[model samples]
Target: QKDGTKERYVYACTPDGTVGRCNKISIRCSEVDEEAWKYVKELMKDQNKVEERLAEIEKKLTSNPVDVTPIDNQIAEIERQQRNCAKAMVTAKDDEYMSQLFQQEAHELAKARREAEKLRADVLRGMDDFQLVRSKLDEFRKRWLDHKTKLEEEPTYTDKRLACSILGLKATLYSAGHLPRYKFTITPPEIEFLILLHRAERQPRPWCVSVPAG
Candidate 1:
């Protein structure tokens, strides 16, 4: 303890305990935790921000239209080649070399067909209909509302963490002009609508503060 004071600091360190890896960066635990919770509360309770996020999700879900016609054509071509190979194989049964060549070609074409079909399916799956998009967005909104209700109550540490997870929150520590600071990053949710996240950049020195939790 410094001067008989029970002081605590949040530290960034290397996994293998390498010297000088973390640049000897640290800050008061209370300071960092307080800053993090502030941002968390802001993000969780801001109804306008929530609506903006939902709008962004809806845009991402419906903005890009996927075309699988090329994939379909590729599959059709592969099938045609397979049919030709099969016919050739029947005629070349007496000739082992020709028969083997046709069989190998047929096998390769079949593999290509499978791959093309899978690509087609993936494209179709990603291209959710308008109704499905609405449903997913509605689900996300409901989840957010539920989380907000929990936040309004006295949320536990687990609840706090769940909020972070739902919002894809991340924390990073670094030095800002000899002062240790934290940066909170929020990535897009992994739920159906894949999109980018808006980050909160705060500092402790002159401009801003940081965010984090235990």
Candidate 2:
């Protein structure tokens, strides 16, 4: 509204208030706006130019150019050294010093071979001794197992003998009227009674006669 020029107005509200002020805007383009637009266009063009240059640089970097001339030269030098070494070997084939060196190496190899053979023999002897010991141990184990089996069976044999002796003593004592009439088939309790009777008879004044006249 200033200077009698009609200007467009816009309302803007801020976070600080519910009511906002009407701001005047220019509807006609000004020379400063044109200059600002020109500046923005120029800045966009420069940015685009920078991006194009960066793309060109990236393409060059991705091409991976390499120079192998130094490596080729090193390979050529190595081949030359190998050829020279071959020529030297051919020239030195019949040298007397080389012959002596070869003979000394052969003698050392033979000495080392003899030592290896001696060590192999020692290892073989040790293996043989170990095998022999293993066999003897096996035999001892068999004997010990047999003795253990006999020991395991010994109680049964001893029990049979003890039962026979008890039966025989019971028969004799019953026949002589020193004990009660016995059943033909003796049980464990009868055997125990016979054992007690025998133990008591071994005392003074033979208790067999005083056993209730049974």
Candidate 3:
């Protein structure tokens, strides 16, 4: 307490060095931290769920491993045929109809080659996304499970901050009347998966104290 009034602690938006200042966007740290911990605790307790999610992600990745060998072979054969057609066209240059036939064959082969290349790219992209989600989930599991004991009992400020960082927690403060209102957002599982797939940057660790959560 400060002069009989309770001291206030908050998370405020950082301001730019010059004229760019935040419009006093801040949330009471305790409120946001408690809410964030509730969600983290729920997730931590559900080991079965976390394992299931990991299994699901692994199944997707393993069942559809990214192998572009077949596509590459297909493209190779198409290009070979295209080269043969070119040779045939040169030899049959006097025969306009035969040359046209070779030209048509070349066009078809080119189209098939393009399609094969596109399929390869698509396969690679899909597998990359799957791998990305799997990696993030693996990291989340490792980080949280490593601190299982501490989490089960009482998490320290550092533990809670770590959880909030991993979970992508966000708190926004606003004023409606004379009182301040705060909104909190926890990253949803599906959206988190998408975010990982899109290669979103990792969240920075929040400023925290070492004291246990009250």
Candidate 4:
């Protein structure tokens, strides 16, 4: 509802006939009032801008492979420094001053290893960000497709039934451990399986297989 308007909007109605108020709702542009249409147009423009930015991010991700050569070289160099420090320690077995020098070199090698590990962690985080963005884009695209279909099509009884079935299956998957239940240390094969499962869940009529009656 607008601040100065007398119009009241009902957003959700429960099975018990209870109505609820909502802050905002998505409506077709043609259905919006003139004052509201202005804001809707602005929102559409903003959505387009966001889509453009996502596309640019995706392009960069696809075109520029993450170069891990620097991290690899850093780790390799640190390893070499540690090996040299070990040799120095072996050579300075008797002299106290030489032993102190070797110990200092060993400390420096440890510091280098720490720095290299931090760099490797930073690179991994960058890769994770890219993957997270891509996953969000895929989810958004799926939701947009569903919304468009609902708005554009005059769904028949069969269509509605199919949609209900899909929703039910999605709910079941959520209840079960099939859908994204929790973040854990999973193998690459498990990750691939989850991706395939999610894709299957998103399909309109995914339950083609027969389930035996218990």
TM-score winner: 1
Q: Which regions of candidate 4 deviate over 4 angstroms?
A: 1-42, 45-51, 60-64, 145-214
Two-way TM-score contest, 1 vs 3, winner: 1
Clashes of 2: 0
Q: Can you tell me which runs of candidate 2 are displaced by over 4 Å?
A: 1-93, 147-214
Q: What TM-score does each of the candidates earn? A: 0.55, 0.26, 0.54, 0.47
Steric collisions counted per model: 2, 0, 0, 0
Question: Among all windows of ten consecutive residues in candidate 4, which has the lowest summed lDDT?
Answer: 166-175
lDDT of 2 at 213: 25
- Per-candidate Cα lDDT values, in order, are 0.59, 0.35, 0.60, 0.46
| lDDT value, residue 37 of candidate 4 | 27
**Which scores greater on TM-score, model 2 or model 3?**
3
Q: How accurate is candidate 3 locally (lDDT)?
A: 0.60
Higher-TM-score candidate of 1 and 2 = 1
Better of 1 and 3 by lDDT: 3
lDDT of 4 at 187: 18
lDDT of 2 by residue, 15-108 (tens): 2322333221111224222332333234334445434433443343335334445545555554565455556556667997875665565565
Candidate 1: stretches off by over 4 Å:
1-35, 66-70, 121-140, 143-150, 155-168, 175-178, 185-214
lDDT by residue (tens digit), candidate 1, 102-179? 889988988898889988987886654444545645655565574546544555443343455445566666564534
